[model samples]
Target: MDIYALQQDIIRYSKEIGIDKIGFTTADPFSELKARLVRQQELGYNSGFEEPDLDKRTDATLLLPGATSIISIALAYPSKLEDAPKGKKGERRGLFCRSSWGLDYHRVLKDRLTKLEAYILEIVPNATVQSMVDTGALSDRAVAERAGIGWSGKNCAIITPEFGSYVYLGEMITNIPFIPDTPMEDQCGTCTKCLDACPTDALVGPGQIDAKRCISFLTQTKDFIPMEFRKKIGNRIYGCDSCQTSCPVNKGHNHQIHKEMEPDAEIAKAELIPMLQLSNREFKAKFGHVSGAWRGKNPLQRNAIIALAHFKEEAAIPTLVELVKKDTRPVIRGTAAWALGEIGNVDMLSVLYEALEKEEEQEVRNEIEYAIDVLKNIE
Candidate 1:
């Protein structure tokens, strides 16, 4: 069997199936990544969403027995949203980061991988293959880097010359010994834009992130956002793109090739007040298709409350007051009280007093008391 000829055939078929970039590498244990993961764990920089076992994350052989080579694939997503709705005083909008603007990328990338697996099986009938996207044990960025998909950028994204850092990456491990491609040279070269632009200084150093402080991570957490980072979160409801957007390599690199990746003007940049009142079913119906909805409606609603405070959207006062008074979730009720304080108007004091009287949870009551103080100071 001519492995070289078969690799060529796979590449051609990949293009036909909508894969933007593909590369191959040996399935050697990722020694460097294992060390870094250890260091990140010691420093508490990991997001806790990653696979916990270091051996499983860095050793390709553990995931698939007899694994000889890995194939990495990338799909470019759009950066700019065309015809995005304008945010005005009363109708303020919060943004889900560009990566979440389209259909959930995990599903999109997995579909591509399944097709590739089927094609490979047809050619090499007995090939043993295993595949995964972001949630998988192997880091997609590490696999992409080793397979020559792109250089690891300072923002920790895989930066491809063709698609910039706006690409979604996935990988497949197989027994076929395909010749590896050369990794890309570091093109970032002394650019501190991404590091400087981080809202919480989450990028502690180039290519190293403290996920705990990252706005992208903070927005996804189910609990209360730390007070220090709450105002810095701005209007981001899902993920934060400040680091990627600040990079020089990503300039003018918006690609809208995939139809499923196109942004729905209203869904991508949704109204802040409306989000505060969405029922679980309503949230699912509107945003379940997007990647950011993985954490469900609570975190988004919490961020929406913070965003309203960021803009100090006075029109949202009534909705926020209602949330503080009646929202079932303590986090929501507390965050709403905090937002009301940030949006300080004399009239809101009456609502705060009413909530303070009825609020049973100590956390919610504390937030209501804080709001009362903020409003009283305004008078």
Candidate 2:
């Protein structure tokens, strides 16, 4: 079998099946990434969401025995929402980042990878293959960068020339000695826009992220957002887009080529107040399809409370009051109390005082008391 011809055939097949970009590279151990992960762990910068096994994460051979090459594929997602709804004075909305806008890219990319895997196995009957999307052990960006899908941008995304940084990446490791493509040179020379735009200084340096401080990571957490970053989070419910939106390379790169990857404007930019009241079952029906729903509705509900506070919407007081007084989850009740304080409604003091009287949870009690103090000072 002609290896180069087979590689070209795979690339053509990838495009026909909706893969925007495809590149091949040797399954060499990612030694540099191993060092970076160690440094990240040492500095307490890790998000705790990543696969914890460092050796498995950096070595493709561990995942698939006799792995000789890796194929990286990228699917471009729509960056801009054409008919996005506008929120009024009383009604505010929260944004899920551009990446989470579509039918979860994981499923989208997995379909393509499954098809590619079957095609390869059919031709090379003895070829060993394994595939993964974001949840996989290997760093998707690192794989894509090495495979020539794009250069690793300053914001830590693979910035493809054709698709910019607005692309979803996935990879397949196989024992097929497909010749490797050349890696792209760094194109983010002297650019500080992504670093400067990071809301929480999560971009510690070019291509280095302190994930703990990142709004995207913070939003996914089940507990309270740190006080310092709450204001920075603003109306973002799931992920933050400050870095990606500010990049000059990504300015005009909205790709709507894949129909399934397009976002529902109403769901993507959802109303903040309505989010707080969603039952777990109701939440799943509405948002379960999107990637942002992975953490479930509690985190998003807490963020909605924070967003309502950010807006200082007097209209949300009743809803926030409801959450503070009767919500079963301590995080929800406490966050709502804090939002009530942030809203600075002197009148809400009575409602908080009433909740404090009945509240038993230590954290929730503290939050209610703190809110009462914040409101009392306004008098």
Candidate 3:
């Protein structure tokens, strides 16, 4: 069968099916990806679910057994001018990162890729198709880079010229061999903007990330966020986009805006006082469909308390004290106690003092006592 013509046909069909960029590469990720994964695993730097078995996914013999070609795809989620938040300073304002601002990429991409797979079968008559997004064991970024979709930036994310790093990636593995595209060169020369802009300094070096220190991982992680990274999380209730926001490559690229991802208008700019009041049901209704849904509202709610504490918003004291009494998670309680201290509200002092008496955890008690000290000083 003619492979070059098939490649052209696939790329053309991908565009028609809503994918912004498409290219082909051999299933092999070469040595770079292997070394990176090895180093990450060696250092025990993985987060978000148990660390996956890398060998099962990366070894071609294990994945596809006889895989010959990889069809890498990118779907763009552009921002719209009208959808931008009204002001810069609010708890729940502005757009989310371009990648997750609309219908989940996993939902949109699998539908289109299924169509593409059907087209491929028509051409070859006998071919195998394996589809996956970022959720898979395969490295989507490495595959995209090898396919000439883009080069990996210092952030270790694929950076395309047309779409920057805002696009979600998917891939189709097939037995049919096609002429592979040449890899792209690293274009982030002397640019440390993403590294500099990170609040927690998660980007430790060029193209290297300690996921433990990353705010995105911390916010979504099931475990307790480290005590040090607490206040630096700012007002971001979900994922942090500070690094991407600072990248020059992402400055002006406008894709189709997904407005559904924006937070509700009434409370989008509401102060921390109200955010701490959201019931579990209320939180689910507001943010359930978003990426942050799985973590529920407790972390974000706790983060709001921390934000208020950082600002010394004494107005949030009543709500914060209420949370300290009712909240069950020790990590959340510890942070709330710290926030109450930061606000230094005398009204909360008795509550904090009482909470300290009942508190069993040493860490939580320490924070409550600290709050009591601040309240005593203010009194």
CA lDDT of each prediction against the hidden true structure: 0.92, 0.92, 0.74
Give candidate 1's error at residue 252 in angstroms: 0.8
Per-candidate TM vs. native?
A: 0.98, 0.98, 0.88
Counted clashes in each candidate structure: 0, 0, 1
Question: Residue by residue across 20-106, what tens digits does model 1's lDDT show?
Answer: 999999999999999999999999999998999999999999999999999999999999989889999999999999999889999
Candidate 3: segments with Cα more than 4 A from true spot = 48-51, 79-96, 257-275, 376-379
Model 2: weakest 10-residue lDDT segment is 319-328
Ranking by lDDT: 1, 2, 3
TM-score of 3: 0.88
- Cα shift from native, residue 249, model 3 (Å): 1.6
